[model samples]
Structures are given as structure tokens and as C-alpha cells.
Target: MEKKKINVAISGLNNVDSPGPGIPVIRALRESKLYDVTIIGLSYDSYEPGLYMEGMTDITYQIPFPSAGQEALLNRLSYIQQHYPIQVLIPNFDAELFNFIKLADRLKKEMGIHTFLPTVEQFEERHKANLPEWGRKYNIAVPRSQMIHSVYEIANLHHSYTYPLVIKGKYYEAGIAYNHDQAVGHFNKISAKWGLPIIVQEFLKGTEVNVTAIGDGKGNMIGAVPMRKQVITDKGKAWAGITLEDSTLLDFAAHLFKETHWKGPCELEMIRTAEGKLYIIELNPRFPAWVYLAVGAGQNHPEAIVSMALGETVTPFTTYESGKMFIRYSWDLICDLKSFEVISTRGELKL
Candidate 1:
């Protein structure tokens, strides 16, 4: 007998204008017809853009975080469970995972809701500055980086490294500095506004490539797609990307799961230097926002994620349209309009 569709809840829908990675994941799952999907938003606002998935999901519920910390997240999850009766919870953001990790075991043990995720230790390495350490441990080339716990630390080590270094906030995005003064200037401002240690890195000039994948915890590769950023926004989401098939890069991705026992979807950023060598830049344990392209190219990563969570075997993905580019139409166009002021309010501007 065919099993009834399982209920799945996707959390962390914070905006509507530009949907996040989870949006595509949910959409893919809905298309797959493999599960009874529920869309969940964690903000108290009750109007997350992800609620747009209401058309696709079996149910839509918004459980606002009740406090300023992890407790608030747990409270919301509890509310979601009682109200929606979802059997699986897929968190889309780092903050959501941080909360889910606290009660992952409890959620599974007490409520029978499986939270598919890496171990807390693995999650820590993936989201924080510690990821480069994994690359080093596996002999993966990583750019020179120094962890800065405070802005003052930058001043002390400014002389140790050359200019064009990167100033990265521990919990925020990074910025490039062409000289010691520039590094310090950006470091001071970011630290004052964003807080904590920043990673000072030697910026590698190269093409940035991102590889997205799904792994089965036990060293088995389920799905992978290698793509390069053809165009990127200042905020770092790839506005356009060209797909490629490189087993060598896939090997590096395989190493990560082999070493960390990672399960679920992950994206690794790599920089190909002028010398043609690729260096691992960072790893995101969650779905890459651009995953929609992979799906469009015939790699259904989100469905693979669901299969893994359900203890089903998945085939390796060997399909991708090499060298094809996809531009995020809305965001890229909006960026152009805002930056160039080329698009007039009344009509499209002529160049």
C-alpha cells in the first residue's frame, strides 16, 4: 500500500518580496507530490513572504518567536507542533537551526518530529569562521585568515599581513580592504556596529564557484551541482551563474561529508585563482538561495533532502546544463534600477 504523505514544515520565511532558498525547496517538494507540506514562518509579523506558499502547502501557520533568545524559538516550535501536527521541521536559517539544535533530540524523542540536520558540532563548523579549519584539516587550500575577536586585534596584526585583506564580522558579512588603513577603517566601523571578532583574510582574486549538494550521513553522495557565479550582487547572492560538471570539486565536497558525517543540503563556496587552483572559501549547511537553478537544470536537491530525511536511497545526480547562465530576474533588475537609476518610474529608461 502506498504510504500517506508525511507532513513537513518549512520555517524561517521572513520576507515576501524576495523569497529565500526555502521557498524554492518547498516549491520543489510540492511539485514532487511526495509529502504533505506545511509552510511555517517564525516572525511575529504574521506576514512573511513565504506565506505565499499557502497555495502549495497543506497548511500555513505563523508562530512568532516569543522572546529574545533560543527559548523563544522553542516556544514557537512547540506551538507549531500542537497546531499543525507536522512530523518534520526543516529550518531555513542559521538562527532557526541554532534554536532547533537545542531541542532536536527532544523534538524527536518526545514529539516524534524528525529534525534532519548535522550534529551540533558539525553545524558550528559550517556556520562560523571555523569552517576553513575543516578545509585545512583535509588539505583543502584555504585563503590566509586570522580570526579577530575584537577590532583592536586587527590593529595588533595589521603589520603582520599585507593590504587588500578581508575584514569579516564573526556573525555578519565580510568586506574587502585594499590597505592596512582601509582594513582598519572597515574593521572599526563593522566591529562598532556589528560586534565581535572579524576574520582578516587575504583576498584571493579569482572566479567564485558554488557547489550545492545533498549527502546521506554515511559517506554516500546523493546529489550535487557545480555552478559558477557569472554575476553577483554586493550582498553576495549569485545574480547569475553558469553550471559546470567537475568531479574534482565534487571530490572535495565528498570529503566534507566523509569527514563530518554531514546530512541534508549544503553549499560550498570556492575561489578559482588565476593559477587555476580552486580554494574552499566557506560552507553553508543550509540550502543555497540559488538552488532554484539547479532544480531548473534537472537536479532536484530539495526532493533529495526529503528522501534522505525519510530514510530512502537517492541516486547520484549527473544532470546539469553546462555553461548555461541564469540571472535572477527580479533582484538583478531591481539592483540595476536602484544603482543606475536607469529605469524610470513611468517606463523603462532608454540607454
Candidate 2:
């Protein structure tokens, strides 16, 4: 049987030490049984490795940074559309999601592009700065966290938080600070990268587990897969993970989607204490870099989201194989300097 052809565009191709979800998401899409995908890789930097990986992208275009605002983004997409006629766009960065979420309607109405993303209210409320209030509203247990714009707030954090607290950026990057000086150092570092209003959260002693799931605009979870990190990098990225048959974690993610009616792919970062209490540490509004694990375990969250974006109904996945493990590794791709020069200078490359 012939597959339906789709022009799908995706961003967040920076697969580095601290990777992005683009490569994994694209891999899932490539394996889709329902569609023949033409992958358009949207990138913010020329150095993003996925731009050069063989068989990864049909074409790649450099896009303006999120700081350039939605108008600039729309213009770029408009230019790309003239060439590829994008039918579905999946944006994977936390910082850029706000712009994409805001433009979802315009992209669809004007350019015939469809995106399955969270509503602006859903995006704003689940922000790290707003997680405390969001937890209370949804009855989800979240750690005590305070958003601060200045380094001076680190001193006052002692009043509410103890040592070994977690310091996180507004969009990404996080660190465990064992003392005041470390906290100051992390604040300066993360703030410089992701900008101010860093969040200081009470550190929970527990094992870190993650859930990657998708929802269909309504209060229905299409699929969810829970995984335990088997290997972690210094940057806190999961280098390896194994799928688990944990009902409590699955129930927690289901409840969250039911309450918020999340409309797209999301990753729930949770910590389970020795006594079995679970606390949500972070809620990523998009798929994680390890999302391919879900596909390997039988969930295929990216495929489900793409199906939903194309106005197809996806049946909820009830079971996935436990003990399915994914170990991430690196490879050296030998590409000539000319390939790099063309993409760097022209801001687009056709592979």
C-alpha cells in the first residue's frame, strides 16, 4: 500500500551534550506507517548536528531566534512554505514554544500549517515560575519553588529552602547547588544562558523517573510511557533509560492531562521518594530527547501526535513493553567543509 505523503517541519535540531528532541522525533516520524514524510529541519544555529546527519532531513533552514518574536518567525515559515508547503509543524524547544503556540491559528489559517500544541494559558500556567500555583490548582504535588530575578534572592532562600536545592532557568538548564556559593554560581551561569527569573526549588531525595505522553486537545491521554533513567550526563540529560510498568506514574500523567487537557507532546519529570511519594520536578511542554524510547516500547508518541495534527483519531495505547531499554551513543559523521559552508552562508541546505 502507498503511504500518504506529508510535508512536516520540525525545529530543535541541536543534538549535543545537552540534546534537543528533534532528532529523536524525526526518527519516530521516519518510521511512521501512516505517512511518507518530507522532513524540513528548522534550526537556529548552523552547528546543530541534525542538520548534517545523513537521511535525517530532506532540507534544512536557519530560522530566527525566539527573541526575534513571532512576526519574524512567521516570515521565515512563510518563506519555507513557498518551497515545501508545510502541512505540519512540530516545534521542540521550550523557549520557542510560546511563539509557536501563539501562532498556531495564524499558521493554520494563512499557511495551511497545522500544529498540535498547548494553549497559551496551559503553557503559561505550567511554567517553572508558575508550577507551584499550577500544582495547587490541579492537585499535583510539586516541590516548593521560588522565582527570583536577582542573585541576592539566593541568600533569602535559606529561609524557605535548605541546602542542596535545585536551581533552574526559566526555559532550560538546571543544577543542584550544595551551598550558597554554588547557588550563586549556578544562578549566574544559567541566567546568562536562558535569562533571568531563575527558579530555586526544594531538592527532593528520590529516584528520577520521566513520562512522555501525548493528548488530543480534549481531556484524553492518547498514550503515555514511563521510563527510569539508567544513565545521566553531567548536564542532567538521560544518556540511557528503561521503560517501566509503573501504574502510579502513569496515573499521575493521566490525571495531569485530564485536568489541563494538554494538546500536544509533554514530558513529566518526577521524583519518587523512598516512601513512595511522587513530586513533579519539571514539566517539559514538548517531547524529550529520549522520546524514541517510547517508540521502541510500543507507545510511538510522536506518531500519535502527528496523526492527531492531521485530523486523525488515534486510539489510546493501553499497554507497552516493560524493560525496553535505550542506550544513547554518539557517532562521527565525516562531512566536507563545503557542506558546512553552504548551510552557514545560505541558511538552507537540501540533502
Candidate 3:
């Protein structure tokens, strides 16, 4: 049988120590039996490793950051589509999801670009600022949290929160502050990077677990896989993780999908307390760095998502092999000066 060839474009290609999901998603797609792939790496920075990594992408192009507004992004994507027809675009960054969700319809209508993403309402409801309220509405346990704009706000935090709490940026970065001084420092540093309104959540004592899953946008969870971090890096990334057998976690994820009708790939960050209670920590509206573990556990969610985006009727994945383990590693790639200069000057590299 001749396998159908599809050109799939993906973003969030910064496969650094704190990696993104692009590379891993690409790997899973490349292993697919449904289609042969022309992996298109859409990157924000010229030096994003996935753009230059061998076997990572057949072609790569630089695109504007999400904050550049939707029209600018549309123009750039239209230009890319003029040359390489992108069948599906899988954007993998938290900060960029808003723009993607907003533009999904336009892209499909104007440029034939397809994407599977959560609706704007579902996306906004999961923000750190509104999480506590959302948790209550969904009948889920969420760590008590507050959003603060000024560092001075932390001074009076002791009234509501303890000295040791978790300080989180609006889009990224989570730091544990053991004291007021640490809290102030994290607040300022994170605020500087991700802008105002850092999240201060009561530090819940528990074993952190994660679930990487995809939703069908129809109150159906397409696939869900649970994992436990066996080894973590200093940055708190899972350097090594193993798939777990946890029906409760899967049931919770299904409940979230049903309640929100969550449409697209999402990683639900969860914590299991000592008394066997589960608390939803954070909700990431895209694939996690450890998404490949889901693939290894017998569900290739990325491939399934791409299929769903391309208008294929996909059945929900109800089962998977448990006890699979994923160990992450880093390697250096040697590249020529011309390759770097081409991407830097022309904003693209094709080979």
C-alpha cells in the first residue's frame, strides 16, 4: 500500500534542557503507520535546536512570536503556505495557544491549514488566575491560589498563605519559596519575564504525577496516559519517567474533558496526596515534554491529533499498555556556518 504523504507544520521547537513538545511530537508522527510525513519545523528563534537538528525537520522557517498579533502571524504563515502546503499545524506552546485558537478558523478557510485546539472559552477557563473557581465548578480539588501584580502584595500574604508557597508566572516558571525573601525574589524575577500577575498557590504536599491526554472536542477523551517522574532535573523537568497504572487519574481526566468539552491535546498536572486524595495542580493546553511516554505506552496521541485535525474520523483510544518508561537525553549537533547564516538572514533553512 502506498502511504499518504502529509506535510505537517509544528511550533515550539525549542528542544532545550527545558524542552518543548515539537520534537517529541514529530518523532511520534514519524513512527506512524497511517501517513508518511514531511516534518515542517516552525520556530520563533533562528537558533531553536529543532530547526537545525538533523532528522528533526525536513524544512524549517522562522515565524513571529504569538504576541505579534494574529494578522502578522497569518501573513507569515500564508507566505510559508505559498511555498510548502501545510496540511496540519500543531502549535505546542502555552503562550501561543490563544493566537492559534483565535486563528484556527481563518487558517482553515483562507490557507487550508488545519489545527485541533481547545475552544477560547475552554482555554481561558483553565488559566492560573481562574483555576480555583474553575476547579470548584468542575467539582475538583485545586490548591488555594492568588494572583498578584505587585510584590508588595506578598507582604500581607502570610494572612492567607504560609511562608512556604509556590510562586508561578502567568505563562511559565514555577518556584517554591521557603521564605518571604524567596517569594519576593521569585515574584520579581518571574514577573519580569512573563509580565505581571504572578500566581501564588498554597504549596500542596503530595507526590506529583502527570497525565498526557488528548480530547475529541466532544466531551470525549480520545486518549489518556498517566506517568510518574522517576528522575527530575534541577529545572524540575522529568529527566526520566515511567507510565503508571492509575484508573482514578484517567477517570478524573475524562471528567475534565466531559465538563469542558476540551478540544485538543492537554497535559493535566496533578498531585496525589498522602491520604490518596488527588488535586489538580495545573492544566497545560498542549502536549507535555513527556508526551512520548504516552506513545510508548501504546497510544500515539500526536498522530491521533493530526489525524483528527485533517478531518479524519478517529475513535477514542480507550486502552494502552501500562508500565512503559521514558528516559530523556540531550545530544549536540554539529552544523556549518552557512546553515546558521541562512536561517538567520533568510529566516529559513531547507534541505
Candidate 4:
């Protein structure tokens, strides 16, 4: 009997410089016996994990942007189809998702690749902070916010909200603000740079908890993992994290999925005030930084997503290894470049 081969590919795997949340997604795909994975991305430089993947996967392709163009994307998809014939395509970053949406028709009809993404209107609605209005309709706690289409609009809406506002750009840029002045400053700078509409939000002070999960698009929950962050860096990356099982958060997350009809894996950042009110801050339509911690805990989110995409039954995973601690944004490695004699005799470096 021939072993069944499952071809899986992920986008946005370019080098590690500001590597997106796809790293763990790819790792899960590669490790799982469910599918043989092929990772794809564009990068100017090569690094550790990518280097390792280059040697392991069935295929690795680097297509430089603009130069890669629509033709190049189609060509790569075609070539991969010629060889491995991918069953599902997982887009990891905003740019790739945008491109996939643009070329989704061709990929579907011509190459027969399944791309998982929200509707264009859904993307735009959430992209421009319109989703929060939906959340508000459902009585979900969305911070008091304003949206600006131009720099001139900013002046009209400047004083409407209180201090420490979060100015966000369409789609991907959700970088926050600490004060009204800072919000305006960032709005002006980002507006000048990107020339996109900005959404200004009232900064909420509270404890941050991330709810990461997979949904079946029909208000059915596949798996949900909540994490309480211990240390978050200035760069907005988690450092020293732990997973928590909270039913209240799960209930809230189910409410969100029912409201949005969200499909696939997404991470929502929520804040809890001293009054114990939980407010939805923002949602990333992909995996989170500490997702590997959940993978380590036994959720197997990527595999669950893959199985769902393949029209397989995805059972709920309840027995997650609790009290799992993790450290992100930093790695400590032993220096094997020196001999023990050089270490002991020269400087007496402690282990």
C-alpha cells in the first residue's frame, strides 16, 4: 500500500527579521504526520529556521516582491502543483493574504488550491475598524474610537476623545498610542508615510489576555487556548507567557465567532480592568507569537486547521498540558565555539 501524501504550503515565510506568527504554523505542519509540508516566502537574507526548513521540506521558493509579480506567483503555484499538488494553502501574513485574495480565483480555478480567507468586505470592514461597530451592536466592549480618512479629518475629531488614543491604519497596522498628543503625532507620521485611513481608539488600561483558537465558521468551536501574559516588550512581543483555561473567556470567544462567523485560526487581544470588565482590544486573523506554547500544550492548532480544511472531523482537544511556561523574543544558546581550556584559563567564565 502506498502511503498517502498530503502537500501543505504556507505563505509569508520570508526571513526571520520581524518574522510573522507563521513560524510555529510551519513547524507544526512539518512535524505533524498528517501532511508533507512545503513552506514558501520571500526574503533578502537567510537565517536559522528558514535554513533548517530549506533542507527539510519538499520545496522552498523565494520570490522577490514586485519582481515576483502576478505571473511569478502563478508560475510558482503552477510549478508546485506540477510537482507536489498542494491540498491547502495557508497564508500567514497580510501581504500574502492580500495577494492571495487578488489571485484567489486563478489559483482556485487553474491550480485548484484552497485559500482560506475572510470575504473582501469582511477584510475591509475589520481592516478599517468597522468590525468594532458590529461588536458594539452585540454589546461587546470595544474601546471608544474614531476613524479618519485624511489628515484634515484628524483635526475635526482630535478633541472628541480623551487622552492616550490608539491610532491604527487599515488592515495590518494596529500599533497603539499612549496619549492624545502621541496619538495625533503617530497619526500624522503614519498618514504621511502610508497614506491610508487611520482609526483612533481610546487607550484602555488593564491586564492583557490573548484568546487564540480555531473556529469551524458555523459558530462551532474546534479548540480555544487562552494565555495570560507575564511580560510584554515595547515591541509588542510576548516574553515569559503561560496558558490558562478560562471558561468565561471561552464563552466570550464563542460569542465573537457567532457574531463574525470567523473561519480558521485567529487571536484576539483582550484587556481586563480593575473593575473586572473585559474589553476586546484587537484581533489578528492569524496565529500569535506564543502560539508554540499552545502547540507544546497539545492543542495542535495547525493540524486541526489542516484537518478541517481537508474536510476531516476535528474533535475538541480538552486535555491540554496546563501550567506550561514559555519564553519568547529571546533565546539563550551555549557557546560551543571555545574549548574548555580557553574558557577556564583565560577568563573563568561561569556556566
Query: lDDT of each structure?
Result: 0.68, 0.92, 0.91, 0.66
Better of 1 and 2 by lDDT: 2
* Ten contiguous residues minimizing lDDT sum, candidate 3: 47-56
Ranking of all candidate structures by their lDDT, best first: 2, 3, 1, 4
Q: Scored by Cα lDDT, where does model 1 land?
A: 0.68
Q: For model 4, how does the per-residue alpha-carbon lDDT over 255-279 read when each residue is reduced to its tens digit?
A: 8877777777778888888787888
Best by lDDT: 2
Between candidates 1 and 2, the one scoring higher on TM-score is 2
If both were scored by TM-score, which would come out higher, candidate 1 or candidate 3? Answer: 3
Compare candidates 2 and 3 on lDDT and give the better one: 2
Please provide, for model 1 over 39-109, each residue's C-alpha lDDT reduced to its tens digit, 9 standing for 90 to 100.
44333333444443335444455444533666665665677678666677777776556667777788877
TM-score of each: 0.84, 0.97, 0.97, 0.81
Please write out the lDDT profile of model 2 over residues 69-155, one tens digit for every residue. 999999999999999899999999998999999999999999999999999999999999999999999999999998999999899
Every model: Cα RMSD to truth: 7.6, 1.2, 1.1, 7.9
**Model 4 weakest lDDT span, ten residues long:** 342-351
